[model samples]
Target: MLDPKTGLPPRFLRTPDAARFLGISIRTLEKHRTYGTGPTYRKIGGRIVYTLDDLQGWTENGVRRSTSDETPCRVFPARPLTPAEKATL
Candidate 1:
């Protein structure tokens, strides 16, 4: 089957590439993963990967026609970022 993203066969995308595809920063994507708010991912041979289908599915969760539209979301960390983690930013 043709991959809707690149017109090639479907393939797993690494974090950086997947972040680019989703138009978000790698750090933001990482935060989503940390908070369990990101796309489903696979850990293969110790490397994190995302399938196009999963990314697309996750994207659909955020679809909104207006700012007033409410779609349940949990994209932020439960607690504020620690000083140490903030230093890395």
Candidate 2:
């Protein structure tokens, strides 16, 4: 359940919130829910619900590690180097 006093979204998230937390599209989430391939969830009073810990575990398992620190993106010069520019080398 969500904690209003803590300013946290929820320990138990609905479908949409859970999908967003997992960095997956809602359709994919639904597919997972249908297939029972994803993390643990509950059908509370006929509505699906997920826990924060379950989502965190799912993220840890399937996440793609970021290489940002090792290699960062950069923009190149807009203009192409001409033959004259090459000659300078």
Candidate 3:
């Protein structure tokens, strides 16, 4: 449902809804959170929430024009980064 003030979806979404928005399973999204590889989120009243803008920005990091095209940033898998990969970031 749209927020009355913004005429858009609510400013923040909880974990399950955010996963649905991104077309990924909730578990995957949780793993991303655990590994620090997911969209930015907020912890309010002890609940985690994600903003639409932050989700979009994280997805955009994976955008590419071609298979070989380089990206300015990357979206990593929901796992710990190797030391080499960490170095690059």
Every model's Cα RMSD, please? 7.1, 14.2, 2.7
Which candidate, 1 or 2, would have the higher TM-score against the true structure?
1
lDDT of 1: 0.80
Off by over 4 Å in 2: 1-9, 63-89
* Candidate 3 residue lDDT tens string, 1-89: 78788898798999999999999999999999998889999999999999999999999999988998876577767898899977875
- Candidate closest to the true structure, highest lDDT: 3
User: Pick by TM-score: which candidate is best?
Assistant: 3
Q: How accurate locally is residue 18 in candidate 1, as Cα lDDT from 0 to 100?
A: 91
In candidate 3, what residue range of length 10 has the lowest lDDT sum? 69-78
Worst lDDT 10-window in candidate 1: 71-80
- Candidate 1's C-alpha runs over 4 A off are 1-7, 73-89
lDDT of 2 by residue, 2-88 (tens): 476998767688999898887777777887766556767898999999998987886555344564333221111223446895465
- Residues 1-89 of candidate 1 have per-residue lDDT tens digits of 56677899658899998999989899888878876778899999999999999999888877789977765653345245679955654
User: Which lDDT value does model 3 have at 19?
Assistant: 95
Q: What is the lDDT of residue 28 in candidate 3?
A: 94
The CA lDDT at 22 in model 3 is 95
- Cα error, candidate 2, residue 87 (Å): 58
